[model samples]
Target: MTQRLPFLDRLAVPAIAAPMLRVSGIELVSAACRAGVVGAFPTANAESLEAFAGWMARLNDEAAAAREAGTAHAPWCPNLIMRRDPARVRAEVELIVRHRAELVITSVGSPAAVIPALHDGGCLVLADVASVHHAERAIEAGADGLVLLTAGAGGHTGWANPFAFVRAVRAFFDGPLVLAGGLPDGVALRAATVLGCDLGSMGTRFIATEQSLASAPYKKMLAASSLDDVMTTRAFTGLPANFLRPSVVNAGLDPGGTRRDGVGAGGAPALRRRFRGRRDPALGRPVERRALGRRGGRAGHGRAGGARAARGIPRVCIGLGFSLKGASETPDGLRGPRPEARRGVSLAPDFLQ
Candidate 1:
C-alpha cells in the first residue's frame, strides 16, 4: 500500500526541487515553495554555519509570511551530507534540530545514527539511495522515506532504471518514495506518481532557472547542453558525478582526458574555480527569465513555472542550449539534437492542474 506523510499531502505540485550543490540557495528554494513545490538546499552549499543559520532564518521568515497571507507554501527542506567526518555531521545535525526543520534529505553516508534525533524533533528524514541495498539499509536505519537517484540525475547519480528501482523498493518498504533524475517537466512529474512515487525530485532543470546561484555563463551552458554534453567522471570528488564537458574545458582541463591523482591533487581545484569564480555575488537577487522548450510541445515559453497551455497541460519549455557562443555539439562521442527544444507532445490537463 502507498503511504502518505503530512508534508507530502500538502504539496500543490507533487514534486520537490532537489537540493543541489552550488546551484540551490535561498532564492531558488523560496521561489520553488512560492510556486507550490517543496524547496531544498544542501548544507554544504553554505559557506559556513553562520551563513546556514542566516539562510534558515530567511526560509522560516518566508514560510511564516506565507502562512499569514493564507498561501499554501510547501515546506522548506535542508540537505545534510552525512559524512564520516563526525565533527561536521554533529554540527550540521545540531543546526537542523535546533531550527526544527520540517524535512531533511541526507546523502553520502548512513542516517542510522542521526534519524532518531531528527525524528524526536519532528523532522522527517529522506535518505538518498542509488541501489536497493542502500534503500533497505536506509529504512533499517530509520529514514522516513527514500529518494531513489536514478540514471541521468545531475551530480552524483545512479544507473538503475527508475521503474525497476521503485518496484524493488516498494516490495519491501511502502513509505513516501521520491524519484530523481531527468524529471524536467510536469509530464515527468505525472509519470512519477503513476510509477507509485510520492514525489518527483529534480535538480538540473532548475539550474537554468534565474533564481539559481549559478553564474550567467553556467546557466547558459545548461540551456545549451543535453544528455550528450553530460560526462560521468570520478576526477572531481573521488565519487562518480555528471558534469558538463564545456564547463570542464572552460576550466583549462581536457574533458576527454582529465585525471586526478589523489583526493586533493588534481581536477578538484580547477572544477571548484570554474564554478566559484574569483568574486561570487550575495544570495539575494531578482529572478531572471530563461526559456526551456519541451520536446514535441507548442511555442509558449515563459519563466520557470510560468508556461501557458491551450487545451491540455501547459508546456513549460526550458531552452536546451547553453553554449555562450552556441556551439552546436560537443566534440566527444556524446552528441544529439538538444532534448529540451522540440515541440508536438501533450499531456492531460487534469494531471497538470
Candidate 2:
C-alpha cells in the first residue's frame, strides 16, 4: 500500500509539475498549483542567494493570496540539486529551511545531510532517484517520498522502465512514490497510479504551456519534434540526460559526435558553472547580473526573455518528446491520435471510480 501524505491525499489532481532547470519559474509553478497540481522549480535557477530569497518571498505571497481566495492549490516545491559545491548546497538548504517551504525536492546526490534540516523545519522532502539503489538510499536518508525518474524523464534521467522501477521500489518502500517520464496525458497518469505510483510527474508537457518560461523557439521546437528527436547524451552536463537534437545542431555541435571531457554521476559542480556562466550564441547577449536579480521581471534560469538571454546556451534537457504531442499541432510522423484527443480521465482518487 502507498503511504500517503495528508497533503498529497488532498490534491484534486494526482500530478506534479516537474522542475526543469530552464523552464520552471514562479509563473509556471503558481499556475500549476492553481490548476490543482503540485508546482515546483529549482533553487539553482536563481543566480544568487538574494535572488532566491526574493523569488521565494514572491511565491509565498502569491500562494497565500490564492489560498485566501479559496483556491485549492497544492504546496509549492523547490528542487535543491544536492551535488553542487558543498558550500552552495549548505546555503541552499539553509534558505529552504528559512522559508519553511512545505515541500522540497533533492536531486543528483544523497539527501541524508539535507533531509534532517528540512524535516526539522516541518518540510517534506522528495528525493529524485533513477534506480532502486538510490531509492533505498533516499528512503534511508529519511526522504518522505521518492520521485522515480525512469527512462525518458527530462534532465539526467534514469534508464529503468517505469513498470519494473515502480514494482522494484514498491517491494520495500511504499511511501509516496511519483513516477516521472513520458507521462503525456490523463491515461498515462492513470496508468502510473494503477502501477502503484502516488502521482505522475510531467515536465515536457508543462514546457509547452503558456505559463512556462521556455522561449518561443524552444516551445516551437518541442511542438514540432518527436521521440526520435530526443537524444540521450552526457556531453552538456557530464551525466546522461535527454536533449533535443535540433538544439545541439543549432549550437553547432554534432549530436552524434563525442565531446566527453566531463562524464560522471552528479555533474552538478561542473555543469553549474557552464549553465550559469556560458552564454549561448543563439540568444545573442550576455547574462546581466541585474536581470538575474529582478523580481517581477523574469528571475530564473528557465523562463523566457531575460532568463534565456542570461543562460544563452543551446537549450538541452527537454525530456521525452512523446509528452509534447498534446500541446503540439505538428504530427510526430509515426502516430496514433495526438494526446489531446483523450480527455476526462482523472487520476484523482475521488474521480477514479
Candidate 3:
C-alpha cells in the first residue's frame, strides 16, 4: 500500500524542524532544508496571507532551484492553527494550497477543513496532536500524517510516556508518524527510529543555530541550562508547555510556583468551568497565545505562548524594522531578498540537544 506522505523518502534527516513562530522564518527554514531536514515556519507569523504567499513564492523558487542544481533539498512547511475562526483559517488554507506547500502542519484544533484543500493542492497534511485519541481523530479527519507531541515537549503537550504513546498509536495506524518531544540529536533520532517512528520532530535545538531568530539571551539560556532547568506552565498560554528558567524569572514568577497573582476573578470562574468540560487530555482547551512575555494565556501576541522576541533580551528587528543597521542586527546570512526586520523571539534551544 502506498503511504499518504511520500515526501519522507526525499528527506536527508529523519527530522522535521518544528514550525516556531517568529523563530522559524524563511532563513531558518532554508537553513534546515539545506541541512537535509524538513524545515517549517508558522503561517501565523505572516501579517497576512498575501505576505505568506510572497514568502512561500520565494521559498518554493529557492527549493526548486536547489533541486535543479543538484543540491540536497527537503520540503518546506508552514503551520496553520485550525480553530473555530473560519475566515482566518480559510485564508491560510488557500495560501498553503496556492503556494503548493508540500507539507501543512495543523495544530490547536481539528484537521477537518484544511485536509481536503491540502489534498486538492497535492500537499501532505500533518496534524500536531498530543495524544493517541487526537491522532485517531485527525486521521479520521483526513490528515495524511500525524505529529505526536509527547510530554516534555516545549509547546502545548501531552503528559504521556513516549513509549506508551508510540505503542498506542501504532496499534491502529501505521502511516507516517513523526514523533515530537525531546529528540535533540543523532542519538535521540536513533532512539525514535528504534521505537518505530518514521521521523523525529525538533524545535529547541534549532533555536540556538545561527539561522534561528532567537535572541542572544535565549540561546545563552539554552546553552547554559539542562533539562532540569526546564519547567511547565499553563500560565504562559493556558496550555501546559515547557519553558526556560530565565523566561520564568523575567516574567516575574516563581518557577516552582504554579499560582498566578493577577488572574481575573470573573475570568477564573469561567476558565474553571471551561476546564471542567475539557478535563480530558484529548480535545484540550484552546490556549491563548500572546506576546509581551507575560505568564499565562492572554490575547494579542508577545511572549505569552508563541515563540516571541524575548523581553529584556535584545530585539533584532532588523529586516522588519527600518532605521536599524548593524551586522548583529541582520539575519544569519542576508542571502535571500533582504527580508524586512522581524522581531526576535526568545526560546530555549537546548531541550532536544
Candidate 4:
C-alpha cells in the first residue's frame, strides 16, 4: 500500500537532520531546512519555556521569510519532551501551537496527549519509536508519521534490524515513515527509500557538521572515529545507546561496564563525572559507580555528545547520485522488504499539484 506525506515533496532529498540534545540549535535547524530537508531540534535544548518560545518564533519567522523569497527551505519540526511533569508538557504544547509550528515530534512519551490540540492547530506529528509496541501505540494515538529508530542508532536505540522493523510497521500503518539508524550519507538514504522508508534520518552525521551546535572537540573526535570506535551500552541512559570509546576514557572512566553506583576513588570527585561505562569487577575495577543519566539523580560523567559517520552532510551529500524519484504522484524506486513489492511512502493524493 502507498502512503501520503505532503511535507516530503518539499524536500530536495528525502532526508532529515535528526535532533540531538544539547546540540542542534537555530543555525543547524535552519541550515538543514534551507538545504531542502526537514530540520528539527528538541524543545529541551532551550533553558526554559520562554526560551523555547523564542526559538519557535525565530524558526517560524525565518522559514516564512525563506518561502516568501522562494528559497529551498523545508519545514522546521520541533522535538517536544513529554516524559515528565504534566503541567510543563501542557505549557510546551501551548508554545508549539502559539508559534504556528508546522510539525511536532514527541519523544520519551506518547503523543496522544497533544494530538487533538496540535491537529486543531494544523500541525503534524511524528513519534520517535524504537519498538513495534511503541510504533503501534503511536498510530493508535494518531501520529501522522513514525521516525523508526532501529539498530545502530545513537542514544537509546532499538535492537531491531531496519529491514524487519519497516516491514512489520508497513504491514498495517502507512504514513510518512522515516528509517533512522546509522544513516550517514546519500547512499544510505537511497537504501532507506528502497527499503520502504520515506526518509533517512541522520543524527550523528548532522552533529559532526559545523552548522550543528555540538561542541568543537566532539565534532573533531567524531570525524576521526569509525565503526570500531562505537560501543553500544546501556550504561548511560539505561536504554541501549551508542557512544564513543574515547569519550568514556576522557571522563576517567572505563567504557567496559555499565553499573550505577559511584565511580572509583581516582575518578573525578568534584564535578562527579559518573559515566555508564563501568569497570569490570573481575578486572580489579571498582563496582560502585553511578552511570550517566537524568534518572537516579546522576548525570553522565560529561557531555559525551556522540558523532557517527562523516561530517558536513548537507554540503557533501548533494550530488552523490540516487536522488528521490517522483512520477505521477508516486515515488518510484521505493521497494518494500527485499523488493517483493513496489510500494513506497509519499505525500497525500493532492501533493503533486
The most accurate candidate by lDDT is: 1
Model 3, position 14: C-alpha lDDT score: 89
Best by TM-score: 4
Which whole-number lDDT from 0 to 100 does residue 76 have in model 2?
Answer: 79
lDDT, model 1: 0.64
Q: What is the number of backbone collisions in each predicted candidate, taken in the order shown?
A: 19, 3, 21, 10
Per-residue C-alpha lDDT of model 4 across residues 157-184, encoded as one tens digit per residue: 5567788999999888878899877776
Sorted by lDDT (best first), the order is 1, 2, 4, 3
Instruction: Name the lDDT of candidate 4.
Output: 0.62
Runs in model 2 deviating more than 4 A are 256-280, 283-318, 321-353
> Estimated TM-score per prediction?
0.73, 0.73, 0.72, 0.75
lDDT by residue (85-141, candidate 2, tens digit) is 778778887887788789888876688878888888899999988777778878887
CA lDDT scores, all candidates in order:
0.64, 0.63, 0.60, 0.62
**Per-residue CA lDDT of candidate 1, range 183-213, in tens?**
7788988999898899999777687677988
Which candidate, 1 or 3, has the higher lDDT? 1
- How big is the positional error of residue 113 in model 4, measured in Å on the Cα after superposition? 0.9
Q: What local lDDT score does residue 221 receive in model 3, on the 0 to 100 scale?
A: 55
Worst 10 residues of 3 by lDDT: 318-327
> Over 4 Å off in model 1, which ranges?
257-353
